[model samples]
Target: MTSLAFLLPIALGMGLCGLAAFFWALKRGQFSDLDGAAARILIDDEEDIHP
Candidate 1:
């Protein structure tokens, strides 16, 4: 019982913090380009180095 009293609030607080961060990101445009990100990695922008 004592341990639960100590741990439950900590667990809930952590969960709420994670939810807040996720919502914050959702409000921003962070997740708006899901498909582009997958396609972007396949592009090769490297150029030959001049010696």
Candidate 2:
């Protein structure tokens, strides 16, 4: 019973922090190139290779 009093606020605060980070990422366009990254893996970087 006493543990709930201490744990509830901590849990809610952590959840809010996670939500804020997700929203910040959305506003920063972090998810805008979702498909580009997946497709990029299929392309080769020829310049980086050395013989």
| Every model's TM-score | 0.83, 0.88
Superposed model 2: Cα runs more than 4 Å off:
none
Residue pairs with backbone overlap in model 1: none
- Per TM-score, the best of the predicted structures is 2
* Separate clash counts for every candidate: 0, 0
Cα error, residue 7 of model 2, in Å, equals 0.3
1-51, model 1: which lDDT tens digit per residue?
999999999999999999999999999978998999899888876673443
Clashing pairs in 2: none
Candidate 1 accuracy as lDDT: 0.92
How well does candidate 1 score on lDDT at residue 50? 43
Cα lDDT, model 1, residue 35 = 98
**Any runs in candidate 1 off by more than 4 Å, and if so which?**
46-51
Candidate 1 TM-score to native = 0.83
Taking the tens digit of each residue's C-alpha lDDT, what string does model 2 give over 1-51? 999999999999999999999999999999999999999999988888965
